[model samples]
Target: MTTEPCVAAPVRRGVAWHTPLSVAVLCAAVWLAHSHWPLLRGGAGRLAAADQGWLLLGATATLATWASAALAQQGAVPRRLPGARLVAAQFAASAANHVLPAGVGASAVNLRFLMRCGLPAARSASALAVKAAAAALVRVALIAVLAPACPGVVRLPGVSPTGAAVVAATAAGLVLLLCGPLRPRCRRALAAVGGDLRAVHARPGRAAALWGGSLAFAALHALVLVAVARSVELPLPPARVALLYVAASTAAALLPTPGGLGSLDAALVLALAAAGAPGATAASTVLGYRLLTVWLPLVPGLLVLGVLVRRRAL
Candidate 1:
């Protein structure tokens, strides 16, 4: 008699845990959105019917952001993923990001999705890290390139010594933890990530997709903000607005808030105000941005997440 592999049992158990937990999380998210529906409606009331056309354009840009993310994710790994399913996964992941802090929800969904696609957890996680690192680098490059074009548009407050020390300590601790106790697995994962990164760079198609998608992702997000700014009649030029968005997003990245909820909103409003947008316009722009990117697609995104969970696609 042949004994079944030990991995099979745990894989099966994981499905059991994953499905219920995902469904529960989806339910909780929908319930939370429902409780906040009145606030969303109030925010929506701010937009004028005259600006509906630009708002629709913003919505289209938001949709494209998910597709760009999927493309970038696919490029991070050598393997080809089914396009439709991968895009769906990104959509679900975006929705998940709003509910969990610092993208934990989205990362969990994507990790599970990659596993279902036959990637081991280590490779999947490596792919994720690669994608994140690439995207972040591209974002910083964009800011560096654009900041000069719009001088005085982006103002960064000086970092306090305490904050600098805290960041340095955190990085040092992480380095120690990885090199000391977690060296073996960390080494393996880093090796796989390095190999994949090298392979992605060698192939023109994958390289273009990775870098292009990342650039497009940041640009599309900025476009959404620009569109919102226009809709609210914010006084800043498009270039200034984009730079302000990039600056605010970079600052907000330091905070682990879910979907950059409070932190991002505050940073954006402050940035816009600093860039010469009236206070009311800045606030409205933030509200409209959140409405399109977060509140509007939330319920449908949660539904897709639940369906994917039940189907074991995540």
Candidate 2:
């Protein structure tokens, strides 16, 4: 009797030099665009230098957002990554995300790190799914809550016809995809992509907690955006500041810019102006915010990348 030869299991892919290099080029392009955004908008010259309170508050809030996001990541996956370890992973992920193409390299870093932490590939994929869902839920809840509080948010030009429609459609589509026949198809698609998902459906309480955490995290980040605005002497309200921050941040994150680099700067300037802030102040505020959030992270990310590469951990 002739026996069929055993099939080979799929091997994990190696990191390629070209991949990182292309991502780096994208990052550089985005960073350059961000650096020049204020100048392009003719607002660079009018910016008031960031004051101490603004810087301090903004920095603190940004840290809080980062920490909370790290915790959310842990909660979603529960690969038993220690807080410190997870924090380091987050930093590495953020660094890679900023320096990678499509911002997807961060997911690779995360997958590798979790695997090293002893999670099965399937479980890790599930964790990523949960984290993504939780983040989306939180963002949606924010828009629902804030849209009412900030009346002008619903009134922006093209808000109702286009933005709102797209938002509603996207949210509905996600809901549909997560239910019934659509869900089965979605799961199959994910499975095709090497996602051996052991389904861990989100419980209501857990979902609430996750969304709550994300909301608080986003709010803190919004406060930082406000601080940056104030630092540039923008005459904008805190509510408007928060609303626009959420909207623009959502847009930038969805965009394919490296870590939303250039898009983020432009988004802030536009959102601030739409929310009634002066153009010059909005432009400068965006520049200052990018400096703290994006530019400040680059050096550490590079350091982490070097270390990770040397250790063969990436």
User: Number of the top candidate by lDDT?
Assistant: 1
Residue 53 alpha-carbon offset, candidate 1, angstroms: 1.3
lDDT of 1: 0.85
What are the runs in model 2 whose C-alpha is more than 4 Å off?
A: 1-48, 155-185, 189-209, 312-314
Looking at model 2, report the run of 10 residues with the lowest lDDT sum: 1-10
**lDDT value, residue 295 of candidate 2:** 61
Which pairs clash in the backbone of model 1? none
lDDT of each: 0.85, 0.66
The deviation in Å at residue 228 for candidate 2 is 1.0
Q: How far is candidate 1 from the true structure (C-alpha RMSD, Å)?
A: 4.6
lDDT of 2: 0.66
Structural similarity to truth (TM-score) of each candidate: 0.90, 0.71
Task: RMSD for all candidates, in order, please.
Answer: 4.6, 8.0
